[model samples]
Target: MGARAALRHGAARIERWLEIEREQLVLWLPVMLGAGITAWFVLPDAARWIGFVLGSLALALAAMVLPGGGRAPRALAIAGLALAAGCALIWWRAERVAAPVLARPALAVFAGRVERVEQLPARDMVRVTLSPIGHADLPPRVRVNLARADAPAGLTRGAVIKLRARLMPPPAAAVPGAYDFARVAWFSRLGATGKGFAPVEVVMPGVAPGADLRARLSGHIQSRIAGSGGGIASALATGDQGAITEEDSEAIRRSGLAHLLSVSGLHVTAVTAAAMLLVLRLLALSPTLALRWRLPLAAAGAGALAAVGYTLLTGAEVPTIRSCVAALLVLLALSLGREAITLRLVAAGAFIVLLLWPESLAGPSFQLSFAAVTAIVALHESPRVRGWFRRREEGRGRRLLRGLGSLLLTGIAVELALMPIGLFHFHKAGIYGALANIVAIPLTTFVIMPLEALALALDMVGIGAPVWWLTARALDLLLWLAHITASAPGAVAALPAMPGGAYALIVAGGLWVALWRTRVRWGGLAPFAVGLGWALVTPAPDLLVTGDGRHLAIRTADGAMALLRDRAGDYTRSMLGENSGAEEELALLSEAPDARCSPDLCLVEVRSGARRWRVLATRSGYMVPWAEMIALCKATDVVVSDRRLPPGCIPRWLRLDRDTLAKTGGVAITFADARIRAVRGGGSHPWLTPLTVQPPFAARPEGGGRATR
Candidate 1:
C-alpha cells in the first residue's frame, strides 16, 4: 500500500512539473534535433552515443533545477534525466568503437556464414553480412560491401566462404551538403566494406548434396506463396522486390506508399494478424477447444512461425526483426491477460534491436520503421484521430474503402512524421508518392507475389520460363506505371538539406512533442518552427546560367533561371540545369526550352536572342565570324564569343596559342565574378598546368573591379 501510494505521488508530481514548464520544453526540441544532426556530422559513422550523453546531461540539469519540494517529483526528474543520458552515452560509445575497426584496411581471411544478402541498384552493388566463424576478438557479425562479381554462378545460404579482399570502413557521404553517409552506415551495423576480387581464389566450403534438396523445398514453398496472389499475396508471402518495377516504385514513392514494397512492420503485422485470426477461427470451429488459454497459445505459435517465414522471404532485415519482436511482445502480453498494451513493449523492442544490431539506429530502414511506429501510436492516441480506425469495420464496401483510406492516411502520416529527417537527409520528396502507393501497394501485394512464386516453382521443376515471363510482365507493368506517374506534374520536389543544428533540435522536439503525452508536447513546437524556418529560407544558388551562358540566367525574387543552351547534348544539357534533371528540376525550369534526348544530340533552348547563333566551343570549332553571316547577325545586337578573337582585338596577339586565347576569352565575362563559369573545351587538356597568364582584359588598378566583361 505504501509503495503504491509513493508511485502515485511521484507520477502526480512529475505531471505537475511538466504542466508548469510545457512551453520551455517545446523550445528545447530544436536543440535536440540540432544535437542529432550534429551527432551525425561529428560521428557520421555512428554518433548516437554523443546525442545520448548530451540529452542525458540536459535532462539531469533540468532535474537539478526543478523547484519541486517533494521526494517523488525530484526522484522522477532524476530518473528521466538518467534514462536520456544513458541512451546518448551508449550511442557515443558504440560509434567510437566501430569507426576505427571499420576503417582499417587489411586482407582478412575470416571464415563466416552468410547472414543476409541485399542488392543495390543505384551503385549496382551487392552487400552481404557474414557471421564470423570463430573470431571472438571481432564483432559477431561483419558486413561485406562487394560488387556482384560472379555471384550468379552460385552462392547459397549456410555456405561458409573464405573471402579475400581489402576491407575498409563504409563509404562516407561523397557529395557536399548531402546526408552523413558515415553515420548512416554506422547505424546499419556495418563493420567494414570491401571490393575488387576474383571468385577463382575465394574458397567455398562444399555443402552436402542433400543441402540442395532443402534449397529446392524452400524454393517451392516461396514460389507457391508468390504465385498465390497477384500483388498483395506476393508481398505478404515473399519480400520479392523484383515483383515491383521502377514505375511502381516511383508511383509508390509519389503516393507515399513505398513502405508497402518491402515486408516492413505493416506486412509483418498483417501476416501475423492473419495467422492469428486463422488460428482463432479454427479454435472456434472445434467443439473440443473451449479454453481461452489454448487460443492464445495457438495464436502465439502461429505468429512466431509466420514471422519466421516472412523474415526468410524478406531476407530478415533489421527492421523486420524489430517489428517481429515488438509484435511478439504484444501477443505475449495479451496471452498474460494484460488489459492494455504499454509503451514498455515498444521500448523493449527498441532495446533488443539496439543490443543485437547496435549500428541499425543510423539506417533509413530503422529510422523509418520506428518513425512509422511512433507516429501510429501517437496518432491513434490523438484526440482528433483517436478511435477513428476502430469505429469503421462494417460492410464490405466500407471495409475496402476504409482499407484504402487507412493506407492513404498511413502514407500521409508517416511522411509528415518523418518530414524533418527526410528533408535534412534527402532535401527532397517525391510529390506524388502518396498516390503511387495506393495502386502499387495492392498490385504488388496481390498480383506480383503470385507471379514470382509461380516462376520460382517452375524453375525448380525445370520449366520456369513461363512463370518468369509472367513475372516479367508484372515487372514491366509496374515500371510503366512508375514512369507515367513520375512524369506527371509536380511529381517531385527538391529543397535544401537541413542544417545540422536545426535538424537536431527538430528531432529532439519531435520526440518530446510526439511521444510524450505530457504538457511537454507544447515545447516541441518551438524547435519545429525553427527547423521549418531554416528549410524554407534556404540559401540561393551561387551562380545561375542560361543554357551555355550565351544567354544569362534571369534572377527573380523566388528563384533564378538559366535558359538552357540549345547547342549542347544531353550530358551538357543536364549539367546546365544545375545538376538536377528529375521531374522537379525540369518543372522548376519549365520556362526553359524543351530538352530532347536523342542518339546523337540533345538540344535545349539558349535564352540568348534567337537571331544570335551560339555554339559551345569544342577543340575543332571556333567562333563563327559575324561579318560573313550578316544575315544571321542582322537581329543579333551583340555576339558573346567564347573562342579567341583575332590578334587585332588583343593588340599583343602576334604569337597566340590555345592557352592565351582561352585565358583571354575566360576573363572577358561579367558572370565570372558571379558563381557561373563558362567552359569551352573538348577532349583532354594534357598540356594544361597550374599556371595562369594575365589577359589583356585584366582591369586597370584605377578601376573599381576587374573589367573582364
Candidate 2:
C-alpha cells in the first residue's frame, strides 16, 4: 500500500505539471516541432525513420481517442502530435529534395549554361553555378571553381560554357555535428564540385530570366561602382558575400557587424518600415482617400509587397524567407489595428518557417536568428522591464543619456540571450560587441541600410551615383570601426567546445523561460543551470586524427593544438575556427620529445594513464630505411601510411591507410583506456549525394589535404 501510494503521488505531480504547460499550448506546439527538426541532426541516418514512425504512431493513437477530460491528457496529446508531425516533416522534406550521388571523385569535361557567378575576393577564385550537364542522373546544378591563375576573362549568366573540370561529391562534415556540407549541397540541388581548367567557352550568350535578373542586377551594380567599396555596396544591396575580403569579414565578425551583413531582420525591418511610411504618405497626399480611409490596413498591404520584393531581390534564402514571413505577420496585425510583432505572431511565424524548411533547425543561422528575435520580443514586452526605464526628463542632455542607456541595455540583453548559442556554434564571443554596437548599430540601421535601399531605387534611373557614394562612405566607416574595435586587446574571446547535449539543454531552458505563461516558468532555471555547468565542465579534445586522412593534430599539455608541419592542416583549421594564430603556435614535426621524423615517416608516443601508445604517420614515395620501419610498426597504436606495410609485420598494430580511407572516407579518433575510438566526418545520410571513386597509385586521405578540402 505504501509503494502504490508513492507511485500515485509521483503520477499526480506529473499530471499537475502537464496541466500547467497545457495553458501555453500555443508556444508549446511550435517548440515541440522545433525539437523534431533538431532530432534530424542528432539521430543517426538509419534511426531517423524510426523516430518518424514512432512519433507518428503516438499522434495517431492520441487523435483516435479524444483527449478532452483532464488538461494533462490534452496537453500530452498535443505534444505527441507535434513531435510526430515534426519527425514526419523531416523525412517529407528530405525525400522531396533527395537526388543522385556522385559516389566518387572524378575528372571530366562538361558543358552547361552558367546560372550564376560568384567572385570570391578573398580566395581569388571565381565560382560558377551551371545547369545540369549531359547526364540526366546528375543534379540540376553543378558548381565549379576556377583557380585565380586559370580564371576565364569573365562569365555571363545564361551563357553556355564548356571546360575541363574535376568533379566529386560534396564534402562531409569535418567533424561530427560541425557542419554538414553534404546535406547543404543536397538541398542546394548541387551534386558535384570541382576545379575547372582552361578557358570557359560561351556556346550561347544569355542569362536565365526571373530571379536571376536580381542577381544579374547586383552584378551590374558592382560593375557600375568601382573598387572594394563597390564590392561592399553590392553585398549590402543584394545578399552576396562572395566579393567581401576575408580580413574585412573577420573584422566585421569581431565587431558584431557580421549579423548585419547577412540579409535578414535588420534589412527587412528597415525596408518594411520605409515602405509602410512611403505608402501612407502617398495615400495621404490624395485628399479624397485621406479623408475617407486613413487606416493602417492599406499601408500594411504596401509593407507586405515591399517585404516580398526584398525577399526576391535577395535570392529568397532561408533567413530572408523567415524575416519576410515575420514581417508580413506583423503587417497583417497592423491591418486590424492590433499590436504587431507580439509573442503570438512570433510563435505563428516560427511554426510557418519550420514547415517551410525543417532542415534549418540544424543551421546556426536559423538558431541564432530566431533566438535573438525571441529574446528581443520577450524583453520588449516585459512590463517590469519597461517600467524600470520609464522616465520623464526632457532636457536635451537628459534625453541623450536616456537614449544611450536604452541602446546599451538592449545590446546587453541581446548578447546575453545569444551567449550560449555563440559559444556552441562559432565558439567565440565579441568581448567588445556592446561597445561596437553603440557605435555601429545606429549607423547601420539608420544610415547604411537606408542609403542602400535608396541606391537600388536610384540605380534604375542611372542617377544612383549620389546614394551609392553615400552608402559606400557609410560602409567604409563601418569597416574602419570594425578594424579598430577588432584590433583592441581582448576584443574576441574564445570558448571551449561545448559537450554533447549542452546546447540542447540550453535551448530547452530558454524555451521554457520564454514560452511559459505563468510564474512557475522560473522552473526552467534548473535545466539552464545544469546546462551551463556541463558546458563549462566538458573537456577540450586531447587528440584529433583525420577521419580518413593522414593528418593528425594533438592538443598539447599547455592547451594549444599542434600540427605536424608536414601534414595538411589549414583546411581542418578553418572548420574548427582555431583561435587566432593557432597555426603559428603549433609545434613543428621535430618538436616533440618522443617523436622524430624524416620526409617519409614520423613516429610519436602518446600516453593514457600509465601506458604508452606509438603512432606512425608516413608518406611512401620517398625512400626510407626498412629496418627502422619494422621497429616503428611493432605494436604501433595507430598507423596512417601511404605505403603498403610488410604483411603481418606487427600483428598488434592498428592500420588506417589509403585503402581504409577509400572504403570509408576520413575519420577522427580519440585515445583512452588502452584503446582507440574513431569518428567518421559524420554519418552519411540518405539525403547525401552518392559519390563514386577511382583511387590513384598513392591515394592518401588528406586530413586537410585535397581530399578533405
Candidate 3:
C-alpha cells in the first residue's frame, strides 16, 4: 500500500510539471533541430545514413499515428518529426556543398583566373582565390598565398595569373576535439591551400566594379586614418579585416570587443534605426505626406531595405545574416503593432538560418551569436526585471544612473552566458569582458560609428579630414581601453579541452533556464552546476603528439610541459600549450634533466603515481638500423616517429609512426591506475583522407616484455 501511494504521488508530480511546461513547448523546436544537427556531425560516417533512415521511419510512423493519439503522443510525434527533419536537412546541405578535395600534396605550375584577392598587410602577403583554367583534377576553387614581392603587380579580382606553387589539401584538426579547419574549408568550397613560388606572372586583367569599389573605399579609409585604427574603421565600413594588425586583433578579442568588427546585431540595428529616423524626419517636414501616408510603415520598409543593403555590404556572414533577419522581423512586428522582441522572434530567426545553412550549426559564430541574443532577451523579459526597469517620472540623474545599471547588468549576463562557449572553442575566457563591454559597446555604437559615417558623407566634398581625425582619436581611445583590459592580471582564464558531454550538459541546462518562465526553471541550475564541476575536475592530458609526428609535448612530475623541439612554430607551440593547460613557456625536452638525447632520438621517463612511462621519440629523418630500432622499442613503453617502423619494432604499449599517425591524425595520452590510455583522432568525415586498412595489434607473448606491477 505504501509503495503504491509513493508511485502515484511521483506520477502526479511529473504530470503537473509537464503541464506547466506545455506552453513553452514551441520554444524547444530550435533546440531539438540543433541537437539533431549536432548528432549528425558527431556520428561516424557509416552510422549517419543508418541514423537518418531510422529517424525518417520514426517520423513517418509518428505522423501516421499522431492524429488518433492523446496530447502526450501528439507532442512526442511533433518532436520526433522535427528531429528527423533536422537530420535530413543537414545531410542534404552537406551533399549539396560537396566538392572535390585535393588528395595529396604537390608542386606544379598552374594557370588560373583570380576570383578574389584579400590583402594581409600585417603579414606582407596576399591571398587570392582562383578558378583553375586547365587543371581538371583540381576543385573549382583554390586559395593561394603569395609574398607581396612574388605576387604580380596589379593583382585584382578577375585577373588571370600563372604561378608555380606548392599545394596541399586542407588541414585537419591539430588534435582531437580541436578546431576542424578542413570542415570549414570544405563548406567554403576551397579544394586546396598553398603558397606561391617565385616567377608569378599576370596573363590578363579584367574589371570588377564591386571589388574595385570595396578596394577603393578600404584604401581611402586606411590612407586617411593611420595605423591599426584605420584597419578597424575599414573593417567596420568594408568588411575587410586584412588591414587590421594581428596584435590589435588579439587585444580586441581578449577584451571581448571583437564583436564590433563582426557587424552583427549592434551595427545592423543601428543602421536600421538611423534609416528609419531619417525617413520619419524627412516625411514630417512634408506635412501633406505625413498626414496622408502610413509614415511608420513607410519607415519600417525603409529600415528593412537599409538592413538588407548593409548586410550585403558587410559580406553577409552567418551572424550578419541572422541579425538582418531578426531586424527585419522586428520591423515587421512594429508595422503590425505587435511585440517586436520575443523568444518567438529569436526562434524564427534561428529556424530560418538553420534551414538555409545547416552546416553553420557547427561553427562557433552561429552558436555564440544566437546564444547571446537568446540570453539577453530572456534576461530582460523576466517579470521582476521588467518591473524594475519600468519607466517612472524621475530626475535626469536618476534616469541616467538606472540606464547605466541596466547596461552593466546586461553585459554581465551575456558574459556569463558566453563563458562556456568561449572556453569550449578557445580554451580561454575573458574575465573582464563585462567591464570592457560596458564602455566599448556605447563608444563604438554612438561615437565612433557616427563620426565615421559623417566623415564618409563629407568625403564627397573633400572636407572630411577634420571629421576623420576625430574618428581616429575616438578609435585610439577604444584601442587603448582594449589593451589595458586585456593586459590586466587574471584577465584570461585558460582551461584544458572541455569534454563534449560537459558542454552538452551546460548548453541544455542553460536553454532550460532561459526558455522557461516558471519556478520549475530553477531545476536547470542543478545540471548547469554539475557540468561546471565536471569541467573543473577534468584532468589535462599527460602527453600530446601532433598528427604529423613532428612535435610532442610531455607533462613532467612537476606539472610543467616540455616540448620535443625548441624550433616549433608559434602556432604549434601555442596549440600544444593550450591543450596541456600550460600557463608558462614550454622548455625543450632535450634540455630537461631527466631526458636523454642523441642525434637520432630522445628518451624520457614520466611518472604517474605508482607507474612510470618510458617514451622514445625520433628527432630526425635519419633511419636507424633495424636491429637497433628493435632494441630501442623493447626498452620503451611507447615509441613515436615521423618515419615508418618495421612490423617487429613494436613497443610494450603503443607505437605511433608515419603510417599510424596518417590514420590517427593525432593522439593524446593519459596515465592512471598503473595503466596508460590513448585517445586518437581520425574520422571518416568527407574532409578527412580515406583511412587505410591495417591489421589490429596483437598482445605481446608472455615473458616477451617486462610487467609493471
Candidate 4:
C-alpha cells in the first residue's frame, strides 16, 4: 500500500505541474502568436506596425471575452496583448523615423549630446551615437561610420556637438528573397545612419566640471580593473573593448568564449549570485537576521546594487537591460516563493525589450543573450537530467572543477546554438573556437576580471601603484593566450555564403530544442541538415570575365574562388579575396588553368607545357548581313562584329572592350565559359565596335583549368 501510494503521489505531482505549465502556456499564447504574426508579413517600403497593433488589440479583446473563469488569466492576457502590440508599434515608429535619414542625397543637421562610441578596429569602422536635438522626426540617436583612416579621436558622453552628414540606411537583409535588413531599422527604432562626419564646433557652455560623473567613475574603474591578470575584468567592469585586439577577438570567438565579453545574463547572474551569497553570509553572522524575511531583504538589496552597477558600467545597452529585468524577476520570484521560471519570464522580458526598444530584436546581442538564458533555464528545470555540477561548496578543488565545467558547458552550448548564425553573418567558422574558449573563459571569469575591477577601483582612488602592475601582467597573459590559440592549425574555416532562410530555420530549431523539453531533440536536425545541404548545393557562377580579360575571378563547386590580375591592383584583388586574404569564392577560382583566359580575346587552344600553350585570339565582332546572322550561326558557332554585319544581324551576344562598345551598360561581360567565343575578323584589338561571339565547344570535354592572380 505504501509503495503504491508513493507512486500515485509522484504521478499526482507531475500532473499538477503539467497543469500549471499548461495554464502558463495558455496565458502567453496570445503574446507569442502576435509576435510571430507581426514578424511574418513585415514589409520594406510600407509601414508594418499598423497591422501588428490591430491584430494584438483584437487578440486581447478575444481573450478578455473568452469563456474562462478567472480574473488572473484576464489580467495576464491584457498584459501579454499590450506587450505584443507595443513591441511592433515601437519598431514601426523607429523605421519610419530612420527612413528619411537613410534616403540617398538626404542630409540632416542637428545638435545633440554624445552618448557613446564603438570602434571596430578590424573593419576600421567607428560608430558614435548622439541624443536627439530638435525634431521628433529625428531619431533619438544617430550612428556614424567613419569614412577616413585617422587615429582614434576620443569622444565622451555629455559633450554637445553639431554636425553635417548624409544618412545611409541600415543594411537590409540579403537572404536571397526575404525582406532585406531583417527589418532592423524597424526593430531598433533607430533614426538614421551616416557614412561620414564633419564635426561642427563644440559648443562649450560653462558647466560644472563633474557634471558627467558616471562616465568619469566608469573610466576610472576600467583603468583599475585592467590592472588584473585577465582581459575579462576590464570587459566585465566596463564596456570598453578597444583593448581586445582583432587576433584576441577571433580567438575568443573561435573558442566560443566570446560571450564572456558581453555583459549579459551570465555576467549579471554571476554578480547577483555572488552578492546574494555575501549578503546571506553577513546575515548568518548576525544569527538574529537569519530569518526568511531577512534573507529576502538582503537579496533585494544586493540584487539591486549589482544590477545598477553593472548596467552603469555596461552603458545600459538593450542586452544588459534585458538581463537586468530577468535578474530582477528571478529575485522577485524567490522572494515571493514562486517556483515558476518558465517561458513566461523569457517572453515577458522579450516583450518588454521589444516594447521599449524594439530594434534590439534585430541585434546579435539580444538574440545571443536570450538564447543563452533560455537554454540554461530549460536545462536546469529538466527533471530527467541530474545536476551537471554539484552545488557550490568551500572545497577549493571542487570549486575549480565546477568552474571549469561551467565554462565548458556554456561555451559548447552557446557556440552550438549560434553556429548557423555566425556562418550566415560572417561566412566563416573557427575550428579552434572551443579550445580557445576553454582556455580563455575561466581565466577571464576568475582571475582577470577580479584584478581588473580591483585595478579600476584603485585607479579611482588615485592609487596607481599596485593596479598598474596588475594591468600589465593581465594584458601580457591575455595577449599570449590569444596569439597561441589563433595560430593553431585549422583554427579558421571559410564557407560559402549561406542563405537567410537557412539561418532562420537553424535558429528556430535551435531555440525549440533549447527552450523546450519535448521529445524533440530531433526537431533541430531538419534545419541543420537543410542548412548544410543548401550551403553545399547552391549554384554560383563558375567564371567572372571582364571584356578586356585584365581582371577575372572564378568559382568552384565548393563555392571557393580565385582571381587573376594582369597588373598590380592589389586592392582590387584583395577585395575579391584573391591574395592572402580569406575570400572563399575567389580562392577557388585560382586553381584552374583550362578555365583561364589570356590578354585580348585569346583561347588557349592546346597546352604545350606548364608555361607554353597554343593560343587563338578570335577577331570577335558583330555583323548585320541579311538582317540576321542566323543560318550559318545557328548551323555552327559564328562570331560577328556589328560594324562588319550587313543590314542587321543579331548574334546571341556581343563582346567588346570598354572603349569599343557604342553603349555603356551596367552589365560587364565578366567571365565567359565555353559557351562563348570571339567573332572572326572583328579586329585584332577591336575598339569602338560591337562584337559577337558563339558558345565555346561545350561538347569538346575540356579538362579542368586553374587561374591565378
Over 4 Å off, model 4: 1-91, 94-99, 102-200, 206-234, 277-296, 339-344, 387-410, 518-532, 535-559, 563-709
lDDT of 2: 0.70
Candidate 3 clashes between residue pairs 3 or more apart in a chain or in different chains:
none
User: lDDT of each structure?
Assistant: 0.51, 0.70, 0.82, 0.52
Judging by lDDT against the true structure, name the best candidate.
Answer: 3
Tens-digit lDDT track of model 3 for 1-709 = 9998996687667557667877677888888788777877777674775677487558757656744344455556667777777877887777677788777776656789998888777677889899888777667778888887777666888889887666778888777556778899888888888888766788988575345777778888899997889989988886788878888988898888887887788889989998999999999899899889999999999999999998887778989999999999999999999999998899989999998998999888998899889988999999998887778999999999988888888998899898888888888788899899999999998999889999999999999999999999999999999999989998887877888889888998899899998898988998898998888888888888888898999987577899998689888888888877775778888888878988788999998888789999998888888999899999999999988899998899889999988877878877664323233333466666422221123343333311111
Judge candidate 4 at residue 195 and give its lDDT: 52
Per-model TM values vs. the true structure:
0.60, 0.88, 0.92, 0.65
Question: Per-residue lDDT of 544-660 in model 1, one digit per residue for the tens?
Answer: 332222322222223343332334454333333332212223222224343332322122323322322222221224444545433322332222222344443321112122444
Of the candidates numbered 2 and 3, which has the greater TM-score value?
A: 3
Estimate the overall C-alpha local distance difference test score of candidate 3. 0.82
Candidate 1: clashing residue pairs, number: 63
| Highest TM-score model number | 3
Clash totals, every prediction: 63, 18, 0, 62
* Lowest-sum lDDT 10-residue window in model 2: 700-709
lDDT for position 148 in model 4: 28
